[model samples]
Target: MEALKQSNPGIVVVWKHKALVDDVYYSNMEVFERVFWTFGPCVEGFKHCMSVICIDGTHLYGKFKGTLLVATGVDANFQVFPLAFALVEGENISSWSWFLGCIRVHVTQRDGLCVISDRHAGIIAVMNDPNVGFTEPRAYHRFYVRHLASNLKTHVRRNDMRDMFKVAAYQRQERKLVADMSLIGQACTKAIQYIVQVPLPMWSLFHDVGRRYGICTTNFSETFNNVLKGARFLPIMSLVEFTFHRVNKYFTDRRELSQTRSEQGLAYSPKVTSIMEKNIAKARYHKVEAYNRRLHIYQVETKRGDRIGRKGGHRHTVNFQLRTCTCNKPRIFHLPCSHVLAVCVKYSISERPWVDRVLQSEAYANTYAPQFSQDRTILGATD
Candidate 1:
């Protein structure tokens, strides 16, 4: 620990120790109760990523049994960017609150942030506490739909019920969500009752503020937890060292990939390009019925089988001036959906302007531009 501090002076490493009484230490020798760490490079790089973050805790299996709490951010390209890590004695209200408080102060001090996590009682309580909870203007807390589905299984127990619940959660329009939930109510009234007990804005995408940025689950943080699965068995310092090297390699590789794509003169990241291509293909099936050039409003009509609604075909309202579509995909993703694409094609307007700047290659490169410095502790000090 001393060596690490000396090598990386910018890294924030916090340790909580028990109070000594009568100028004497305890005999048990468990001096440290909790530890939190956030590398300097990660702190700097997170500014380029989205304001949304996901947090989850995993059990450590080493000689010292404890919980590993991890918080991760999402980059413009939808890649997972690890932020901070903490080791606590257990997963409880106090532990989670302490960890969250540290993150709020050190990492995400900005307002209008969104946090995603499972519905753990501890996490929920901490996030809802008026004094400590991230609420209203500061931040919004969202529940992971996948975890909710798992809990719903105990009541519904049917694969179709799970599928319907997912459909309702992912719907960006309240009408569509109501329709799907009605279907669930028809099939299993109990499932609908259970889901409605919780606020729709907490889990449903339709009512969420624009901060979610298309992420509906805590799977990204879980994926990072899985990446460090084997490292949990090592000692605390060893685990930290392993994570440092692993994250360095991750940033290095992604930086190279982004540079290669930029050299190709790509406007957006590969994932965004692929999604745009698919949307363009779907756009061909829809035709623009009316275009008010002065108003920048368009009315598009879909063919019989290309519509998303229950009806055979439907008309959508697209206002390029406001960068929105009645279907709600454009407003949610900050990208032009198929309907908007069709309108843009009819007007001969380049879709590039409609694309969100965050999805572009430049943002992706900026996210990984910070370099992790080598620790002199690992390599002997230079003359």
Candidate 2:
């Protein structure tokens, strides 16, 4: 633990052990219970990433069997950005509570943060506990849509249940979501009932109000777990070392990549730029009518597009001042939607300035700006 702190400044590593009883064990003897750690670079990088966090647990196949808990965030490039990690005996209320507490204290203190995880009883209980401070107004807890779909499929005994749930989960527009839910109800009443039991805002994109940033699952954490597949088999110290090296490389590689992209004069990450390009192409099929010139609000009407198969005649309101569109794409994804793009094109306004900072190249570079002590390779240090 001392070595870790010495190598990485501002690193937070915690070790918890069972208290020894005077009658049972010696004063110096203690049993290890849990350990949590977050890299200094990762802690600093997460501030530039999305506010949403995805957490998951994986089993350890080593001699001292345990579970590995991972917390990851999504970068502007839509890649998994590892934030914190823990090795606990198992997934339980006590361990999960302690893990979450450590994350709040050491990793981030941002309010209105959104946390996504499986429907684990331990996580649900801890987040619901008022003392834990994971509830609304401080943080919002949501279940991964994939896990919810799996549970619904298991309970309903229907093969199509998962597909139906996914359609509803990915819907950005409220009317589209209603149509998808109606279809699910017609397909299986039990499935819709099972899904409705879970809060709409918890899983559905339409009700998420851009809190999820278009992420509907815990795949980010799961992907990081897969990267540490071999490390989980090692002992505690070995596992920690393995994770440290891998995460250092992850940050170094991404930082360099962002630097190269910035050198090419890219305003946004490739993922964000690609999405914007598609929206720009679609914008050609939309006609914009100015509604409030002072407020920069316009009503955008869509025309039939053969390439996108978009049905024409849908009207959407775009407010440039608020950076919102009635289609909800801009608010949900933090980028301009077709309607907003059309307004920008019609008025000869630049769309780059309207994109959220989280998706911009500058923010992406800032996310990976911190250098690990091991390499000391600096790439666009925003600090």
Candidate 3:
């Protein structure tokens, strides 16, 4: 622990032990139960990433088996950004509470942060507790749609259960969500009861208020788990060393890439730029009609095109002041949709303000700017 702190200043390392009882000998050493650690660079870099966090736990293998809990964020380029890691005896209320508590203290205290995870009883309890920082005002707890769909499958016998649930879960409009839910109900009446048991906001994007950033699953954390699959079988100390090197590489590689992109005069990161380009192309055919100049409100009507035969053109209302479009894409994804871009084109206004700051190239560079310690702390390893 001292060595870790010495090599990586600002790194957070917390460990817990089993409580001692009166029956135990006084001289007996405390039994180590779990340890949680987050690199200094990761903690700092997360500020430039999205506010949404995805957390999941996987079983570790080999000698001294345990469960590895991971928390990850998504960068501007939509890449996985590992935040914190923990090695616990198993998944339980105490372990999850301790892990989440450590994250709140050492990681981020940003309000309105969204955390995505499975329907684990331990996680539910930890997030529901008012004393924990995962609750409302401090943070929001959201259920991963994949997990909810998985749970729904236990009750509904339909083969297309996941697809139906996804249509409901990913809907940006409440009316569309209700329509999708009704379709599910028509197919499997039993599913409606189980689905309604969980709050709409908990599993559906329509009520997420843009906190989810369109991410409906814990796939980022799961990807990180796959990246560290080989290290999980090693001893605890070896695993820690492996994790340091892996995360260091993650930072270094992305840092160089972002610097290169910034030098090339890119405004937004790769994913954001791609989305903007697509929206701009689509906006070419949108006809905008100004409503209120002071309020920056306009009605954008999509011109009939080749695909209009099946999917008719849509007329959307865009409000620059509120940064919203009736299509719900801008508010939900924090980027200007085709209709919103159409308004910008008509008024000759710059669309930069419409984009989320975190999705910008500057933020992408900041996310990977922090450098990890160069010193290799592996046992009996030379520089």
Candidate 4:
């Protein structure tokens, strides 16, 4: 392999699918069981006091021909908790059910806030089905992937659903889902509603992307995918090493990020502060009951010509602010209105603070920092 690599610099050694890295690497049933079973308690223990759980799944291209992996985590301070991982056929209900069941068992606190994830039928199935949960309110959850759908692609039969995506996202849309999923689509919609209802010990449990005071979706499993990126292509021993190394790096980097954030004095940089203030001001856009009534009256007058309520088509009419657009986003659901984005523009108010910290790098860890005393406490650093 070394000789071949030396000769062909571009060569990527492709191993057969489902190849185990160790005797226990998915091959040893006991090891597989251990890895799989560890998910619930591990996550349960990790998310003990947290309010929201951000969930997502990605394909871990490996020896298992075209197999995928699904996982979830809590995103406090952008910290990642390894909830679970399973080699699965595809990202669907069955896979999510198994994963959620593990989490449900581990999530003994019958009262944590909802889990957030991208809107795939699999996740929606878990969230929407009344039978999926053991008790009341059915463990509320939400889906933020509505932005993934585009207008030409038409994610929602009702205009309300399509309108829920980021405005820019909806305008520059692509049709990924071909067949129209009417019932299943609604199930996903209801699932999101459930997410908002889950009781949170505090508002901090949920993230308000765009700072819009609503549950916005971020790909929670994105980092896990990064951890697995090149590791998936390596051989067994290499894969194991890669996992440990990256996970180690993940923790190391996270610690550094925390310390750096602390030193930066909570005041943000001028540019970021400007953006944040703008977003906050945008969020400040509030009106009383009269404002809503006036808006509703205007909408009735303008959209009177269109048979919006009758539902001649799969699309439903959605209302937002002064706009009575036909989409499920703001009108049907009080979530962000992608249509508003189309008419107005990206409101700066709803953006979250954590995302901006990465680029400034000021509050982010200097990856190769020198280690000093215990806890890697910088030689001159305090706290």
Runs in model 4 deviating more than 4 A are: 1-50, 74-82, 107-110, 128-138, 151-165, 168-218, 234-241, 263-383
CA-lDDT, candidates in order: 0.80, 0.84, 0.83, 0.39
The parts of candidate 2 lying over 4 Å away from their true place are 1-8, 20-28, 375-383
RMSD to true structure for each model, in Å: 3.8, 4.5, 3.0, 14.5
Candidate 2 pairs with clashing backbones: none
The per-candidate count of clashes, in order, stands at 0, 0, 0, 25
| Tens-digit lDDT track of model 2 for 1-383 | 11122323656677776645545765665677778888888999999999988989989984879999999999989999989989998999988998888888788889899999988999999998878767887888877888898899899998788988898899988888999999999989888888888889889988988888888876788788877879878988778778878998898889998888888899999898889898888889898899999999999999986766667999999988888888888888888898988988889989986788888888899999987675322111111
The digit string of per-residue lDDT tens for model 1 on 91-110 reads 99988998888787667687
| Per-residue accuracy of model 4 over 1-383 as CA lDDT, tens digit each | 01101112211121113325455355432222111222122333343323445676554455633233534454333344444444445677866676566556433345534566665677777776655562235455654544343321352344544443233222211122111233334546653343234332112112222221234446456666765787555543344334445544655666565455547664433434554454334322321122243343211112222334532212223234433444333422222333233223222333222223322334333322322112211111111
Which is the better candidate, 1 or 3, if ranked by TM-score?
Answer: 3
Tell me the TM-score of each prediction against the true structure: 0.90, 0.92, 0.93, 0.44
Model 2, 45: alpha-carbon shift in Å?
0.9
Q: Which segments of model 1 are wrong by more than 4 Å?
A: 1-9, 20-30, 304-312, 376-383
1 versus 3: better lDDT goes to: 3
